[model samples]
Target chain A: MTQPTAAVLLIGDELLSGRTRDINLQQIAQYLEPIGIPVRECRTVPDIEEEIVAAVNALRAKYTYVFTTGGIGPTHDDITADAIAAAFGTGISEHPEVLAEMAERYKAMNTDFTPARRRMARIPHGAKIVKNPVSGAPGFQMENVFTMAGVPQIARAMLEDIGPRLEGGARVHKVQLRGPGLREGDLAEPLGAIAKAYPDVSIGSYPWYLGTGDNGVALVARSTDTVRLETVRGELEALMRGLGVEPIPDPL
Target chain B: MTQPTAAVLLIGDELLSGRTRDINLQQIAQYLEPIGIPVRECRTVPDIEEEIVAAVNALRAKYTYVFTTGGIGPTHDDITADAIAAAFGTGISEHPEVLAEMAERYKAMNTDFTPARRRMARIPHGAKIVKNPVSGAPGFQMENVFTMAGVPQIARAMLEDIGPRLEGGARVHKVQLRGPGLREGDLAEPLGAIAKAYPDVSIGSYPWYLGTGDNGVALVARSTDTVRLETVRGELEALMRGLGVEPIPDPL
Candidate 1:
């Protein structure tokens, strides 16, 4: 069976403005990878309604699952829920369960459950809540799209709640081989040949900076078939030796 | 004048696989912000050819500039350059100058300039080379799309070369106000009213976790008009105070 593919839609002007560096994509990707749902694409857009609607529609249609982060708070800028509703052509209303949860949490703190705070209870029609352990507000899942918090901690908690429900496909296996003190040009020919030979395995070369004025490249081979992956890795090590460089098991 | 918008397309499977966390989007966004070109969107796609071509076409058409990083290497997975050519329906060939530069660098290092390394010399028709100072392989510009290396250091170096030539637009002015120990629900009503009152200024609220079991929210206002931005900021501070929370000038 084909591995289930996923896409991540990160929403917020803060992300696009460089005010906030997104940690959610990597977190979500790592979380989904073990479950055999590899995130094939990720798009970060500003807090615009039309953009969010368009991205949601496009990604949801293409991938098996679409996860969105940010814009579910009480502020006016938190329009992700609304946009998701618009994308699905559904109406949003305050969910009673979520409202009750937030109300109890706020009541305990002696805080008035204001309209803005109550806004967190608003979810798209027919969506199921993705529980948040870190924050009081709950994320929601509309169809295959999972809308979670932008905060890294909260997004992680939501993922934990959502992970078990997913139907995972084949788990991918990976092998890493590092070539220190080697120019990419030197290894290019053999690496390309190996990639061509092992069509089943996806081979990638990444150059790293050691902060000591020296650089190195790491060769990564990924495939679902363990035998093909190992064969490609062995060839990669031999190629590194051919260039008079020893292949290290890891970069560090 | 409206600020010129740009989009960053990060192409690599390593990024999607969570093998590498992307630092390029923030770097590019920060660099462009100062020059009056704001990055409005960023999309990360795997090393697949069809994905690359589709992203390049979509982003380049939507924004004033589209900056792409990764897949310009010599490996078989490095199909970004070829995909870019196909996106524009143009042919690619090894540019003489780029080939000469790579040949000189390899000769100096006593390395054989293999076909894989020489592949970096290929450029799409009518494209200009964006010089790479760190590595010898030069990135290229096919119209508004600037293709650079996947490596952070090299991508940064290529941006330095491309920064000066860009036609920047109006610089955006910004003001930030922080409200510590304030629930977003409490601040939501006044904040939304303020946002509605000042349509020109874009207001954003970001929640922060202090690692001490306490949360804070930062309010940011951005506009082209400095006076309006400050006026909105002042109102935001007043709104925070009205909600019994003191507004800090900045987060730090």
Candidate 2:
């Protein structure tokens, strides 16, 4: 069966300016990978309405699911909600359920539920609210587009709330081995043959700094079938041993 | 004076797959900022030839300078030279200057200069070579596009070689202020007025988690003029102080 694929749209000028370090993509990738939702694409755009609308429409039509982050705050530059609403050609209104939850949360925290704060309750019509435990402002889910906060904490909270609701495929298991002595060209034919031999598995090689003025290649085998993954891993281990190097474990 | 602008097109599948954490963009941004080149846009595409050509054409037309990283290796996926040539509607050839450098570097490092490695000596016609100190493979500069290596170390080395050759504008000075124990609404009108007052400066506010069970707002002021930047910074600092906030130093 074909695994479900998703796409992420990161909207923010801070990211473009290199002012804010983005940790969300990595975290979301890790979280979704375990659930068998492979992220096919990730695009980061400035918090401009046209850009957001264009990206949302393009990604929404292409992927099974679309996730967006940033521009959802109660500030001047927060145009995510309006942009998404505009993408779907739908009007936004104060979601009663979200409003109630925000009101209760604010009251419990002894924070005033000002009009600006209520702006968080305004979500696209027919959208579901993704609960925010850490912050009062909740995320909204409409069709396949899940709009979350730019703040890492709030994004995580919303992700946790939504992850369990989505359908998933069999999780892929991965094995990795690292070595520095051998050049990539020497193993090209053998590596290609191994990948061809195991149609069910994928083999990948990455170059990295190995310290002590050394460079190394990390070979990885990934497959949804555990047996195939293990078989490929054994072959990689044997190859490393033959090359007079010790095979290491996958970091993940 | 106009603030200099640049756009980056990262050509690689490794980044899109989340396999390689990218350090090039951050490093490039930091390197260019002090010299007054502000990177306005960044896009990452797989090593597909057409995609690379399209990205190069689109970005070069939109910005003062365009920088590209990755796909300049000896592997089959390394089609940056050809793609760039296609973008320029030119042809590719094994430039003697690049071949000479590669041979010298290989001889110095005592490594075999294989035929596969020589593939990197090819450059797009009429393009200038960007010297690579750490490797035999040289990057190239064609029109506004500065194509460099995918590896952070090599890309950085190439930047050091080429940074001095580029034109620059007035370096924008930045100031930051933080206000905790306050909501965004309370500062919206004042901040709006501040934005209106300093038409030459750009002001932005971001909400942050204090990790002390409190929330905060990070206010940033950016401008090309040193006097205008300082004046806006003073005003923002006074506003924060009045709001009972002890603002922190610029996080940047």
Candidate 3:
């Protein structure tokens, strides 16, 4: 089966300004890649309405799915919901269903459900709410764009809630091996052939430093089938023996 | 002086795969931010040639300076140099001056200078080299785009070497204050006035959890001049006091 592609739009000024470190994109990639959904493009823009709308439209048209994180909080910069509604040519206002959910959640915690807190209940008309387990403010799903929270834990939870609902492909299985005393260029051609032979599998080579005057390289073979992934791993073991190097287990 | 805007292009697949955490963007931001250079946009693309070229062109056209990290290695996927050359419509090959520098550096390290290893000497036409003190492979500077290594230590070193050469504006001074018991919307109108009055400064409001169930809102003020920044900070502090909230010093 052909693998599906996805694109990520990470919106926040703090990330671009280097004030905040982004963990959402990596988490999203790790979650989707093993399931054979590769993220083809990743763009980071400031908390601006126009940029958010433009990125959403472009990525959603090009890829099967578009996942956006951030700008859904109760702050002034929280304009993602409105911007997304505008992009889809839909009207947005404070929805009663969302207000009930927030009111219930905040009431259970004995927090005041003030008008300020109620601002989070604003939702675009006809959008499905992706429930937030950790936080009261729920994310929304519209068409192919799944809006998730920016906080890593909440984003992860929201993705877990919505991931299975989306049609997913077979998981890509990979055997990753790493060790010291190897150069990446030396194995490129052989690895290239391995990639060509499988056609369905992807073999990637990465090099790292050991900080002890030694170099390390990792060879990963990713496919939809476990048996094919194992075969490639066996071949890599044989090649390692021929080069007098020991292959270490994947740590990442 | 008006601050110059900058952008980043992180070219690699390893980062997306979560195999490596990116430090280049943060380090570059730290270096430029103190000098009043605001990083506008950052995009992460794989080693694909077309994607790299498109990103380079787009970012270069938008910002005063565009910095790219990764894909300048001695491996096949290390294609940032070639792609940058393509983006500028220039040619790239092993330059004798770069080769000579690599040869001398290799001699000092007592490593064999093989022809394959000399691939690191390749540079685009009409490009100036950014010296790498730790590694023999030199980074290149073409027009506004500075292409550097993916290795975090090496990337940081190259920035230190090249940072002083670039024109920089006056550094922006900043102050931050947080009110643990207050909500963002409660302070919105007054903060709006603060933002309106300080046209040259940027004001931001962010929510944070202080553990032990203490949640709060933080207000930040930024400006190029130290006096104006302090004045804005004082105004924010007075406003927080009026709301019966204490302003805390920003760790940032």
Candidate 4:
């Protein structure tokens, strides 16, 4: 069976402007990896509405599901909800249920239920609520697109709720092989031959730099099949041993 | 005149698998941000050639420049060079100059210049080499697409050579306003008013979470015009002071 694929759309000017580093991409990708729905593509766009609508539509049409992070907040820059609504050609309004939740939350904190604060209650027509326990403002699921908060902690918390909703196909197995003073150029021929020999597992060689002179090559092999993954791991370990460098076991 | 726009493409399965966190997107964006060429969009795709080719063609057509990282190494997974050539419908072969450089470097280091090592010398036809001082293998520029090494340091080093070639339009001025206990919901209305008044400037509100209850909102205003940026900074400072929280001046 073909695995269900997903795409991630990271929204905000902070990320694109380098004011904020994005952790949401990895958070979502890692969450989906074991569930069998691999993230095939990821895009980060600024706060512009046109750009958001275009990216959302383009990605939603291409992938099985689209998970978006950022721009769902109480501010002028928080236009993701409206943009997603526009992309789907749907109308958005403040849901009474969500408005009641926020109102009760403010009452519990003895804070004013101001108009600006009420913006958080707005939801696209026909969208399901993605609960947010960290903050009162809940993320919503508009069809296949799931939108969440931009704050790293809040974004991460929302994923717990998002994980159970997705139906995954193939869980992947990965093995990373590293050795002392290993160089990619040195391992290219042998690694390439092994990659050609086994078409099922994808083998990649990456050089890791710890310091100026201290560096090593990390050989990674990944596959949906665990047996193939373990088999490649053995072959990689033998290859490193042949090169006079002992394979370093992963340090837990 | 409008400033040239750029997009970034980060290739590799490791990135999508969460095996590696990408810092290249921020590196390239920050490098281009001050140069007046803002990174309008950034996409991450796997080592698959079809995905790479599709993204490259789409981005190259939309933006003034496209900066692609990863998949330019000597390993079998390194298909960026070949994929890029296919995107442009151009032929690729081993460049004599690049081959000669790699051969001489390997000879100097008393290393074997194996057939797989020769793969790094393959450059797309009608492309210019981007010199790599760290490794003997160099990056190449094909049309408007600038392809570089995947290694973080190597990718960073290549930008020094990439920066000088592009012409920029406007250098953006940024002003960040933050205060103790500043909340986004409290600032939305006033912030939205300021944003609407100064349509030329893009105003953004991002929450900086220190701990569970120690979060503060960071108000950022960006504009190509310096006078407008300073004007908004004053307005934002006044807004913060009116809220009973003194504005904290930027440390740097």
Q: Return the top candidate by TM-score.
A: 4
Better of 2 and 4 by lDDT: 4
For B1-252, candidate 4 gives per-residue lDDT tens digits of 978999999999878877788899988888888889888899999999999999999999999999999988888999999999999999999999999999999999999998888999999999999989888799999989999998888998999998888888789888887777988888889989999999999888877878877778778888999998999999999999888888876621
Best by lDDT: 1
Task: Tell me the lDDT of model 2 at B221.
Answer: 79
Estimate, for each residue in B52-140, the C-alpha lDDT of model 2 and write its tens digit: 88878988997889889988766445678999999999999999988887888888878777665777898999999898887658899
At residue A5, what lDDT does model 2 achieve?
A: 78
As for candidate 4, its clashing pairs are none
Per-residue lDDT tens digits of candidate 1, residues A1-252? 877899999999988888888889999999988788999999999999999999999999999999999999989999999999999999999999899999999899798988888889999999999999887899999999999999899999999999977889888888888888876767777788888888888888887787775778888888888988888878988888988889888631
Ranking by DockQ: 4, 1, 3, 2
Report the number of the highest-DockQ candidate.
4
Q: What's the i-RMS for candidate 4 in angstroms?
A: 1.6
Candidate 1 Cα misplacement greater than 4 A, ranges: none
Score every model by TM-score. Answer: 0.96, 0.88, 0.92, 0.97
Interface Cα RMSD, each model: 1.9, 2.8, 2.6, 1.6
Better of 1 and 3 by TM-score: 1
Chain B TM-score in candidate 3, rounded to 2 decimals? 0.91
List DockQ, one per candidate, in order. Answer: 0.69, 0.37, 0.49, 0.70
Q: Write the per-residue lDDT of candidate 3 for residues A7-107, one digit (tens) a residue.
A: 88888877876777888888998888766788888888888899899889988998888889988877666789998998899999888988988888878
State the lDDT of candidate 3 residue by residue for B64-167, as single tens digits. 99999998877656789999999999999998998998888878867777655677788999999998987768899999999999888888999987797778
